[model samples]
Target chain A: MNPATHRHPASYRDPAGFVFEEDGILYRQIHPRYQPSYEQLKQSGLYDRLVSEKLLIPHEEISQPNTADAFRIIRPQRIRPVIPPFCWTYNMLLDAAIATLRIQTIALQHGMILKDAHPSNIQFIGASPILIDTLSFETWIKTKPWIAYRQYCESFLLPLVIGHHGVPDSPKLLRAWPGGIPLETGRTMLPLRSKLSLHWLLHLHLHARQSRQGDTPKSSSTGFSSGQMKNLIHSLKLGTTRCHAGNKHSGWTNYEQQVSARGQYTSHKLAVIQKESAALSGIDTILDLGSNTGNYSNALRNISEKIIQLESDPQTANALYEKNKTAGDQNSLSLCLNVEDLLPAGCDHGLIPSLKSDLVLCLGLLHHLTYRNYIPLPDVLNLLAQLTNKYLWIEYIDPTDPLIREHFNPERVEQRLIDLETFEKQLETLFTTRYHTQLADSSRRLYLCSKK
Target chain B: MIHLLYLDPGNGSYLAQVIIASILGVVFYFRNLLYVVRDFFYRLLGKKDRSADS
Candidate 1:
């Protein structure tokens, strides 16, 4: 092993291999115990098929120093800015469930089976979901039932159904129970109508009852045929598709409809963004704060190499994600997160930065942070300074504006003394103003600033 | 005589999946068969609901 290589903390659970990083590059070390399955996976052409179909992350073998207890070292194409389970939207979780079924179906076609079905094994790159765990495949036995069946039900099936049934907090269930939500817990929490559905009755209610009884049939891998396994996979696919199709629209699903209410204001905002963004050079990554339904990010899509759309609302984030998926747009990634309180521990055990951006956009978000959230103006500026290494494009809304007055208390605003002059003075401590423009017929102003 | 059974949670879940999936497969086959038979009788009698054409 290389002396500088560091093993990721989350990679400790899997015995087949562990992911390690060496000098900014991520690599997976395959154990000798997995040599047979790894060879079979490649020789059977499963790896090539999955990669071509964009279902799995592609990797290339690398000759590293470690040789004693390792069969090989492979480095996969890193999926940047990984979105965690807590940050996933309802449709995003459903998309992940569908992707898991697709991976299992493809594996079965190549005479192999997925040994595990953990949600962490899958990550979204833009709108598409890709399997990140390369060692999850194993040769299928003749008569054995799928070992990952229960895990699939808990992690993918149950969560999708819960989210579709209007539990916006379903993603938190995964965080609370990493192994997966307990079947008995799911049975108790699901609505009465859910039990009447045949899919739920079989997968959740009966499964939970049987699990509590602890009844095991005799082990027989000999009688299970490939056709039977295919049937199981098909049933799971149908269940997941039904869940995804049944997702009900909630808060902020139609947020874009309100943007057209102020046609001139929106047009002017777009023009300023396009003109100011044109001045930036060598821009690689962009972080759009409060990216409600990703309208501005979609407008500036051609300006940056990649854009991470961060929205605090799950419904709004999912609306953007569905659009991205339909367009096959690989440049924009949407995540559900509260910008005011980002958890550093959640970012792969602090191995990666919680947020990275070459240019940060704070359009139509500062007033809410300062007035609604009560975060001080200087502190908000400082946070933005830490997030971006280069430029910051921000919008300032006057307290007297009709939109601002509706949401703020006049006495509170007067008490805070958060005027534009005070804000500009505070902003100067962290960023030097490059350009400023005032919107037409509004108390709104856009500023382009560089970190001081 | 009554027999008591004991098994770990893992094996128990696997057994449950096998049983449920097998039953579902058989039920689906029969359900499809019933639909096919109903359609056959309708065709033989040359009787179809007016709403079906719409």
Candidate 2:
């Protein structure tokens, strides 16, 4: 078996089709069982309408089947910087919920409905969320209630409401319950005030009780009408919109202001970055470390195809993500992540190295890793080397710098760095410097290095 | 509807769903009825289809 044509771990649950990559190209193989629904999706014009509106990821049917059991094969454009549900901001989660509702509405208009409403079925390209699961649609039966209703509530609505209530760790709940936060679990966790709201009472509280009692409304007459489904969708949209994270201050939210306060230093740093980035070539993806407000990555927007901005603080990362999304900068993806605990080996169900970059940009982050995080310089260099495939743009901060001093004790700082020569010697083990320059009137030195 | 009621298990959940569906069905039926009634009068007065004209 060719390793390149292996099936994705998350794609196995859906028996209609499974996603596979062949020679770096993603393809979906539709099973023979899904032929009827697939034909209905196309014949009903839902597929064309959705593709035209960019609500669904468009695919081109392959002429030749890749495997013998395949009823049909299709090639879909790979969306980069794939993020998990837990990392999404409150607003992003709401956007996802709205997107799911929109898909359901459109599906119903075409005499179809979503078979499942899991967050994993959706992917964000910039701020816009697109449904990636083509097989989620099935011909709507008036007698059958919305089978995915409970799923929608648990996966999208519950998480958004939890986040809106000032719980920042709402997304983490997804890790524990991959199917979604259970209805009973959410009902218990939500505050008493939430129970008073009609939307919450009907969807969360009553729904949970019904589920616990093993009450399945399966009979034809007991099934809800299309009108009721529409009403439910409307209520869900309004409920999701009302759930807000409310303004809460965090440390890195005002990082751009601090940088601007050092007037000359900011401009000098920007100029140095612009000059160095302009000289680089053959770089498509960039992994930016400590991308506070995405200042450096945003500067390289024209040159890089995709920029994955990794920031430790959630507020700062979310602010940058929202800004990029609003501007429709499709190439930039901001994520809240600490470099100290980069990518866990097997956390995302065997989807290893979620984001890989041709080039890495580590600007004003060395001190944070070495001083604050207590990561040795050699270990830091090794991790950066592993993440980047080709080039690295790293910044070395002098011990004399105020930011470095603030993060580290004076004695520890002295012991760690010792001298500039020692730091350069450590970096030489993994990467060779291509371009090195000291910024004007600043103790920072920027190096454009390439893996040896 | 009677057959459906018989087939369903004697559970309150199905009954609740039936009630909710009935209410929504009534509202939807009336909402469409108003438009149908309006169209009938318009045609009776020898007027063009208001929906098509719009």
- Candidate number of the best TM-score: 1
lDDT (Cα, tens digit) per residue for candidate 1, span A176-265: 766678888976777888876777778887888877876445533324656567777777777778775344455567766766776588
lDDT of 2 at A23: 77
Report per-prediction Cα RMSD to one decimal: 6.0, 7.5
TM-score of each: 0.89, 0.85
Model 2 CA lDDT for position A445: 87
Which portions of model 2 miss their true places by more than 4 Å?
Answer: A1-5, A64-68, A216-221, A343-352, A407-418, B1-54
Model 1 spans with C-alpha error above 4 angstroms? A1-5, A64-66, A215-225, A245-251, A343-352, A415-417, B1-12, B35-54
- lDDT scores for all predictions? 0.77, 0.75
Deviation in angstroms for A122 in model 2?
Answer: 0.9
Candidate 2 per-residue C-alpha lDDT over A1-452 given as tens digits, one digit per residue, 9 for 90 to 100: 23224876556666677777777888888888999999999999999989888899999887866566788888887787567766666666777888888888889999999888878777788778888878888889866666677777787778777776667547667767766787888877888888766666666677677667555535435656667767667666767777766564587788778777665777887887788778888889988888988888899888888888877676677788788987889888776666776633324322225666888988888887787767788878888887888899888888899787775788777667635787799889999999888877688888889998
Task: Tell me the lDDT of model 1 at B7.
Answer: 10
- Judged by DockQ, which candidate is best? 1
